[model samples]
Target: MAKAFKYGLKGIRGHLEPAERELLRSLFDDVISMLEPEERANEDPLAALVGLDTDAREPSDRALRRLLPNVMKNDDDASLEFRRYTERSLRENKIGALKAAALSLDREHLVLTPDDARHWATALNDVRLVLAERLDIRDDADADNVHLMQDWAQAEDVESYLALVYNFTTWLQESLVQAMVHSLDARR
Candidate 1:
């Protein structure tokens, strides 16, 4: 039940209830897990469809594919080759962003320096993207339907709660971006 984000002179400022903060921490933890390189090779057939298995290395998960898209979609050989060289570094950058988000959550009040704000924006967008996929949110209309259904959705409905969180994060990201833009404009 903390206020939504707003830009401050120092950085972005906001507040989140302890429970909300914990939820965010959990989300980042899950993302980190998903981004982790699998010990065994990917067994997903969908990877083959995308020609992600062209190389000897394991293909990435669908979520990872969304996060780090192909460098060359038309040429399977080039795309897989590029992925092999860059996927590790991309994963590392995502992990770093998630870690930064967790560090921000450690504070009582949410305060983000410029660097921290960038990390939060990156991490939060990733979380939202994953959640939206899980929720099958195709467009604004689908998202609106989710909100409309909230009136009938029970408090115990996990799906409903997740949708609420997705919506909340979307708003937070939008607000943070707006604040940053305002700050930049002010300096002119």
Candidate 2:
């Protein structure tokens, strides 16, 4: 079982079983794999013809498209240009968030400084976003539909597991956010 975080004067603390930590580590690994920029071959015929590499274009992966959404939705050229300039930095930030969370998992109990708590919040949000994409969950209605399918034996598979993880992460994120808010309030 996973534990909810509680804020302290020093920081925030939570406990997770080693297996739980491993599960989260694997999820983070998946997200990192999907988000990491890849090197393209210089021999692309398309690149030769267009004088640019198509692989250098905006993300073609569905999960990535969600993670780094276009800044300008209506204009393709502008969106692509913006993505080209900003996506690398955005990816690095996400990677940093994931790394912070992973570092917190090195022990049986997590102790996150205020900044680390913030990073964990970002990491949780990113993980949820990727999981949502893989699960094809578009809206709250879709999430509810997954819940409705819980009784069916077939639904007790990966879809069900993903939904459970999604729900769990949501609760965990909420707990962390609330703790942070209360800490801030107390300080104020």
Candidate 3:
């Protein structure tokens, strides 16, 4: 079992069992793989260096679209134009956070600095978002239904297993956010 993260004298700290740590690391890696931009064989060096993807289009994957949403919801042209200029950097930033969070999972004691907390929060949220998409949790009602699957013994299918993972990540993220709030309050 993983302990909920809490803010205290030393820092924001928590404990994860070996299995929990492995699970989190795997989740983080999955999200990182999804966020990584594809390499272009004959791409413009200058444009790539400047983080511009001239041929960038909206992601076809529902989870990816959620991660990298349009700047303008109703206007396709504007959104594509903006994505071409910004999506690369956005993907890189997300991947960086996911990697950092995964690395932290290797630590014996889960003690996080403020920056690490932010990264962990980001990584966990991203994992939850992906899981939610897979679990078809489109609304509060859908999420509530999934949340009903609380027992590991009840995980008879892949959906049930995913729901359990989603619920775990949601709980973890919530605890992290609360600890972050406590850290902020302490600094005031």
- The backbone clash count of each candidate, in order, is 0, 0, 0
Ranking by lDDT: 3, 2, 1
The runs of at least 3 residues in candidate 3 whose Cα sits more than 4 Å from the true structure, single-residue gaps closed, are none
RMSD of 1: 5.9
Model 3 compared with the native: what TM-score? 0.98
Best-to-worst ranking by TM-score: 3, 2, 1
TM-score on alpha carbons, each prediction: 0.82, 0.84, 0.98
Best by TM-score: 3
Q: How would you encode candidate 2's per-residue C-alpha lDDT over 19-110 as one tens digit per residue?
A: 88888888888888887766656566554343443344667778788888878868988887766556766887899899888877889978
Higher-scoring candidate on TM-score, 1 or 2: 2
User: Candidate 2 regions off by >4 Å?
Assistant: 41-55, 147-155
lDDT of model 3 at residue 163? 95
Alpha-carbon lDDT of model 3:
0.94
Candidate 2 steric clashes:
0
TM-score of 2: 0.84
| C-alpha local distance difference test of each model | 0.77, 0.79, 0.94
